[model samples]
Target: MLTLPGYLVHIRKRGGYRKRFGTRFGRGMDIPVKRAGARRIWIQAVSLGEMLAIEPLLKALASDERIEIYLTVTTSTGYALALEKYSELAVGISYFPIDFYPFSSRVWDRIEPDIAICAETELWPEHTHQAVKRGIPFLLVNGRLSDRSFKRAMKLRGFFRTVLLNTAQVYACSELDRDRYVALGAPSERVVTTGNIKVDVAIEPVLDPVTCSSMRAEMGISDGFLLLGSSTWPGEEEMLIDAFRAVREHDDRARLMIVPRHAERRHEIEAMLRERASDLAFHFKSRGLPERELDILIADTHGELRALTQLADLAFIGKSLPPHTEGQTPVECGVLGKAMVFGSGMSNFRSIREGLLQYGAAREVSDEAEAIATILDLSQDPAKRGKMGEGGKAWHASCKGAVERTVKGVLSWLDR
Candidate 1:
């Protein structure tokens, strides 16, 4: 079954499959066995975003000489990022085993973790069962239960509650999340509201002034107003393009830089742009310097959004624009103090959105027309833009210390 075309393609593309699969059968392969008297910690994050959220915790844990860390990720991108970012700190990085009784038991035996931490919403019943049966502590850190997810979980409350009860504790991201988790079968006493770790994201801009200026020049926007559409999703790109067109109708010097959430969709996005409006000249960041006459810069590359956000005069976070999707994190824009706009579907980051609104840090638009109007208004009024930017910086600063609080909470559990 693993040799089928689609499965084979996935495994080959991800690489190191044999070694990773070996770990599922209690074989460590090249991974060093844990020291006899050392504490072993297994941390699992489901994807890139979850991995990013757990960075502060990882760094803190790495500093402790008595602890050994083993990190696992479910997705190919996440596994790649783990190796790139944490190879030195971690004992080993591997793909998470399939969450079946046999596979989970094999991995449990191999790692023999003193504790297991799952970032965000990555809950596997078999894994939890194995941990519970082995008497190893299992914790769900930075946990959240969105309304949509809560509704679905409620339908299987009996089973889900049993699985959740196996966890030693659940550190929820918000009070609402705590309540929802309780309603869905987690013991109220075992859950605590630790706030969202994402709010404490480290925002060190990768580009300095010289490099930023060079990048701007290369993208044909050294002197113009740059509006970044950061981490935009599929349908959100079209809405942004339309908004950019409207903005350019009045200010031709304005430029739109879109960094799509998925870089692999660059070709699809390019095709869509051509189909929607072929007259709009755009260049892909991966292809080299853009033409001097180009109006749009498609940052179709990975790990560049942070630097790009720093360059923008204003930004619009994606995923929110489409009614069905719950929006990407705007915390990066907030942290950078950028004047920003986002669509109505921001339930995933509801607390962050509300905080930004209370401080006048961001504007929420219900549709494309509203987004265009707000973007144009921000572009024209320097004073308004400056105020929004400052407000965002203040809001983001106020939201710090979640990481410290979360680390403290995790340590309490580990100590016990």
Candidate 2:
């Protein structure tokens, strides 16, 4: 029952994949258990942030000789990092097959997974529906439903409701989120709250110099700057720079470093500060741009952020700015235990944002004016900075079991 459009997209993806033999299609690509005999478990975490949550699950699953994990992602940056970070965990990392009826059917028919773990909310009707038809248990792990996501689901209420009946269980990230899922047609009895698996992504703050050095040196940043902001977005930078300048107005010794969210915006970001902050510097890791000398250092690159965030004393995760591309709140900052600040546009990250605020792990600013005020206060107050970092770290440690709990629930569901 393949639609023409689905068929065409499948053929296109297959052909595109075929064109790049070992480059992308090489055996090193992900190998999930889609076959009857395949002991593989397919775990789909879309990118670096998701990969952070997935890493711990992968590790916990590693102790099981019977379990083979097929980790899948779309972005090249994700593919490389998964290979670099979790090389030894399970099977392989590769492109997910296009989700057409026949293609997904073919993928499912081959891998024949006994049970599947759909992390976060990547619920493709075609994929889950096929799993349903085949009697494979589909487990939703670390799930959450924003009010915004909930409203959208109500539109597709019946469709998602069908998706729910096929799912054995879902370990939602929050109680309110669980309620949202049930309201959107997830089976109320099957959905359980297990908090966020993001907490498990926090490692013991390795503070390893070799990995940190390799990454930082490559990004043209040294120990001098405070590495205040990790991944900044557009309008936020002007606000942040203003805040940093305000910080300078109080403490001139403070050096700041930032990484923009998009690589393409590097030139514009450089240009944005040229007239006023002419001493600003730009380094591109992709094009072999050498680490150079300048005041405002921009790590305009990719694949190094996980390690690069280590150098931050106080990290401002971008994408929390107004009209953002919908920011991610830099959950990785919590892993680094750095003093964090974000804008009030954190409606999307409500639970985590409030959690951080309660733990005194972070401060949320409402706008550019407030941003300046907060930064200036923290700049002159080293004690506040240290306190925030300590509080964030403690809270981070207390929430480390998310991955373990999630992985176990998935296996239990599939086993059922």
Candidate 3:
């Protein structure tokens, strides 16, 4: 009953809706029959970010011969990425069943996993309760609560307490996260600080310099200082475009790249580009490469941020500016050794932000004007940028090993 409205609204939308419609009702899931004598572990990642963050953990578990993996995602893009990236590693990849009534139970019965894991803050009551009822240990990996989420959870304190009670363990991203879980009624003994797996994802660059140079050439960006807007949300794009214009006035070689959080928002961003920065030559990744040289590139695609961030001289972590709280992950930028800037709303990654600032890897701005000024200043300072990049690499190195800790803990629990 609670999910009916969301279900109806989801189905009414376009793009992979019909294909995912059945999964919500615990039907049409592509989970394979469990292998005999194998320990099947069911892992649920809510979307693309969660899916990417959990990749290392997935690989670690897959290394064990006795373990079989069943991975489920709650978004179309996440399912698509799973098929593209983890089809071989994961025994089966499908949409997570709706976390309500028979839907959750039906899926649970079908998989009959020895252990159930939810990534980050995706602790659905019905899902956790289903695992508890079946005596299956439920785990929350890389768990965190943003400032906004903590406040909301306190409002529904009773409800969250019941959910936490069912969870066997929570692998938090930081000490603060551990405290937040404990305050919300999660048993302190069950909550452990495991750092963040996102650090693992950004430990090294996947693309080589030659490949990065070729990619830039393909985008018609030749030797220009690239300013990337990583995982931008609404309003961030406009601010970036304005900053880019200002940046270009100072440095003619400055290039802009905007990768919005949702690829579906491509058209919206395109329209905005036409309105705000009509004078600049821009190209969209969704469309083929431009015939002429381009000054701006819009990456309106999925699973390409890592590749794009590698090409950036300076990057902006989006969703941190005004009107949007709970910022996007800056771990990738920091780990990739890029000088970065973000707005004040980094409560989602509060610990990481503090670390990055402390290490001189990133700069935090108060608003759009300050962000623009900071970007402008950083654009011309090669030595400062280099130092910042080194700082980012240092900070990222210090934050590594969460995946290893999480894998060891999970396997030990399963053995017990």
Candidate 4:
């Protein structure tokens, strides 16, 4: 197959990424390097979550004197997080060269990796083809195939078949996902069911009532109020506005906490929330809030929401409430020791969320009325809420080690 001018394609890909996700994940920058040793392992993760999934592997490989891991990401956000979180293990963070022929060739020559591992379903044709052309064994680790994405991929069988075959080994997230890969032309022998690596998050229970109370107080949430948290994605705020209002009619004074997926969207979401709840004041806005009349408090920042789960009397995680994204966040309100409410549209994070629900840690509902009622029910019963939180923490702890398994896969490729 023919390709476009390498420089022009590179320029366009860079510009487009800058325009759409540049602010969120910066233009992938090629870091200036001075290393006498060559990278034996080139690990490419597109962004933050993908980058995160590979941390265990990097840690595991750091011990090998023969191996050098070169980490690369497509977004600035991923780069920043990698530098911040995995600086000790990641040898170098560079922009993944945009997939144009000669540019990719230049990248491969510069790094001169013996092996390359890409996380998830990111199968860039140019990159893999070059790796194959140069005889560098390539592997896809932690591959997932949601029914929706797999069906669409099957449509492009002609396009993806060669690329699939290029992968030396496939570490799928599940057996069902493995079958999906097999259908997509991945050799069954190369496919192995490696459980999803997201389960490796260090989710220890943090019991800081004083700090939790202060955060809630700063956000204008009074005692005995429900905290509905909307994590990442668009369109979730609108869903929760109606959801919260419905809860208020029954509870009189309900508190809502919204944390958008992107921190930059906070101002936009705050503007919308202010118009809807004109009387409410929030800490983010710095407006004087009545201790009692405050209904909704927008969490316009990051890093604290996961910890703030402890303050929710009864919680509703936002992304799941709306169809903006495929699945809901499964906010782990239960992780904070509370049976929080979710929506019927828990298409995202289905398996993990289902596990929480099966353990009686989370409960899902159809609409605002049902969600509100569930929160209120949990609020009225302390025993039930405490039990749910305990269950969630238990389940979260039980599911650790995704990172270890992923690390093993990355190391195994060194032999090939």
Candidate of highest TM-score: 3
The sequence of per-residue lDDT tens digits that candidate 4 reaches over residues 306-414 is 5666667767666555443355456345445566767766654666677788788888776656765676677567788778878887877776676677767767666
Error of 2 at 85 (Å): 2.5
lDDT of 1 by residue, 63-89 (tens): 888789999887766777788889998
In angstroms, the error of model 1 at 81 is: 1.7
Clashes of 2: 11
TM-score of each: 0.92, 0.85, 0.97, 0.81
lDDT per residue as tens, model 3, 1-416: 67678766874563566666788788978778888899999999988898888989998999999999999988888888999999999888888887788999999988889999999999898999998899999999999999999999988888999999999999999999999999999889999998888887643457888999999998888677899999999999999988888888988988999999987888888899899888899888889887877889999888989878999999999999998888999988898899999999999999999999999999999999999999999998999999999999999888788989999989987798
| TM-score of candidate 2 against the unseen true structure | 0.85
Off by over 4 Å in 3: 10-15, 202-205
Local distance difference test scores for all models: 0.83, 0.69, 0.90, 0.68
After superposing candidate 4, which stretches have Cα over 4 Å from the reference?
Answer: 1-39, 63-66, 204-207, 217-223, 246-254, 283-295, 302-304, 310-313, 331-338
Ranking by lDDT: 3, 1, 2, 4
